[model samples]
Target: MSSPRPVWTGLVTVVLAVAPALAACSPEAAPPARADAPVIVPGAPGQSGSGPARSPAEAGPVAADVRFAEAMIPHHRQALEMAGLAAARTGDPLVTAVADRVADGQRPEIAVMESWLRSLGRTPPPAHDHGTGDHGMSGYGMASEEDLTRLRTARGRAFDTLFLTLMIRHHEGAVGMAAQELRRGRDRAMRAMAQDVVSGQQIEIARMRGIQRRLASP
Candidate 1:
């Protein structure tokens, strides 16, 4: 009626009235005070560190790692050979069971170590190789040929006692080797295998000791 406000005035007023509401509804609106979004702070450039995480398979093996695999392959083979003799030579169920367990556990581990060595373009020791004497693996508690011979010919409870004693010593040697690998090896897979050796063999050592005590008591 007041000559009707200018049409342009009405349009401008409408836009101004909606502007605040539009901003409030926008996707770019500020989050609430309670927002818990995670903030990722990137590392400083050229920082000296271990760098990004990698899996064991991605990591390269060091000399100690290679040595560990090489030594352990033959070590486990000897253990399996001893375990194989228990079934035919010992009448004790305990000896038989432990022998089977040792065989079952070490057989796969030998395969794993051999495959790992091959993957690294290194040759694994032969199955018959005991790595004794100048090979420098005897410190790891490997049984001597004479020891194996005595074990082979022994029978009954005598076989059980000797087997447990030798196997306990063998496991102790494995634990020591694993400790060395843990100390010096760089490959994650080999280190992990070393740890498995430590833990598994330690338990077996304790069990064998208990069997020894039982065998001694009665």
Candidate 2:
């Protein structure tokens, strides 16, 4: 007669035989998280704006989510344009540093939003579009063409002051937009992105204000 199977081997066989059924009955057997899911970064110490990350597979985008992405894309583009002007225009180390930070943070966010739109079978707006029509600049705090021109032309300390003032206003608008998304958007990924916008830009706004105060002093 063949030797009896070892106890450990028998237990392993039993577990293997039952594993599929166990998984089928388990709540934790949900599909793996999507790679493109938006993750909300925690806010700095003492701040209250952090949010939970969720998989894109969890929910479909609502109209609010679409609108938020469409509008924010161009809004962030304009920000990049402004940030691009910093290296050549400003002598202030603080201004240059903040501009670099803005560009660094928002550039990938724009890509994510655009990719999200494509994933929904929607076309992203033109890169040059500054969120016109239904999502106009009224509440978005976007600088006007004239404002951009002025920013383009100014140099030295003048550029630093104007850049900070405009960026503070711009950040305030983004925060407002993010807040709206949080209230009305249904997609978990979009909501996560919105929360990040709220947390990040608010911090930048405070920093910009501090820089403004420093600029104002003798």
Candidate 3:
């Protein structure tokens, strides 16, 4: 009988020899994504406001008011990014419309908040990254690179379903952030914005949940 050890060694050698060739024959892979995984969008840095700064005492009843606004500007911006993905990438008209509204509504607010921050003589919290800050105000629930990958890969109804679901969660976090501002904010302008966030996002949240349900039905 042939020695089992020799037979095993031969099989191992053949498998090793085939592996590199198999890898070469596979489909071409895309370049690795960044750790932060920002989507590639071409644009100049937005125009900055030269508005006057507000005193710390002028901000709100508690530190939470200022903190909420400071944290939320970036959170809202992230939500806008997800909305942009739906608008530019997805095929669903419903998704595109919702995304368009989100993008349009938030852009003006970004400017408003930037103006508010400038008035305070403080730079707007870096809108890009917020690695866990005070009072658990985590900007917003940012979708992971994996989430973006899945969104990019999905199409048609599947893409709409994923976008709506992720957006619902993202909006819910915004509601929380806005509520904190409403509760503690002293600035009338800032409080007004927070109230708008709560009202607008709540309506949109209902709309998103409806979309999710419709997509789920047979």
Candidate 4:
């Protein structure tokens, strides 16, 4: 058994014996590739630049809040129209002044409420045409067709009387709606707005009533 000779050489024997030991020690030593995860490269931190989007409902009121806003917007629009006519038609300096103030006050409120409705993903209801013709909500008083005709046809003091009477009725309707909100509403801003409506319109109603009495006498 002299050296079963060099059939299987020393080098061949050494490779066969060492290969298993090396594999056992290494055990798949390669690291996971970088593409497999987000790289947290070292640098200054920064924001994502994108912001969370607001939902339609998140932008404004919803549910009963939406219904309230819808109803109130048209109502406020009507009030503004009435106020404008009072300003244009009335001759009594005090009545005209009040009308101007009322109109100015209501116009902005109309815009705010309408914006709120849009934000809430709601449509404002169509206003009823009270047939004042082009006069808008100024025609919304308890006055009949004949009364409105008198209002349109009259001048000076006559205009003042009709305007005050109509405005009183309009303010009453607004007060009624505001009261409804006080009773049934939950939104903080809207309810606060309703309270403002009540306070402001009530004062106007009183002023109109006084104007009516003053205009009626003699």
Candidate 4 lDDT by residue in tens digits, 118-176 = 44334455556433333323323434557556666767787787677776786786677
**Candidate 3: tens digits of C-alpha lDDT, residues 90-177:** 7777788788778776766666665554544446767664223333645455566677678777877878988888788878888888
State every prediction's TM-score relative to the real structure: 0.72, 0.72, 0.65, 0.60
Q: Please list all clashing residue pairs in model 3, or write none if there are none.
A: 52-119, 53-119, 53-120, 54-119, 60-186
How does model 3 score by TM-score?
A: 0.65
* RMSD in Å for all candidates: 25.7, 17.6, 24.0, 31.7
Find the 10 residues in a row with the least total lDDT in model 3.
30-39
Model 4 residue runs over 4 Å out of place are 1-62, 126-150
lDDT of 1: 0.70
Off by over 4 Å in 2: 1-59, 130-134
lDDT computed for candidate 4 = 0.54
Order the candidates by lDDT, highest first: 2, 1, 3, 4
Off by over 4 Å in 1: 1-59, 132-134
Which is the leading candidate under lDDT? 2
lDDT of 1 by residue, 111-215 (tens): 767766655445678866854543557677888889999999999998998999899998999899899988767555667678778887887888789889999
TM-score of 2: 0.72
CA error at residue 92 for candidate 1, angstroms: 1.1
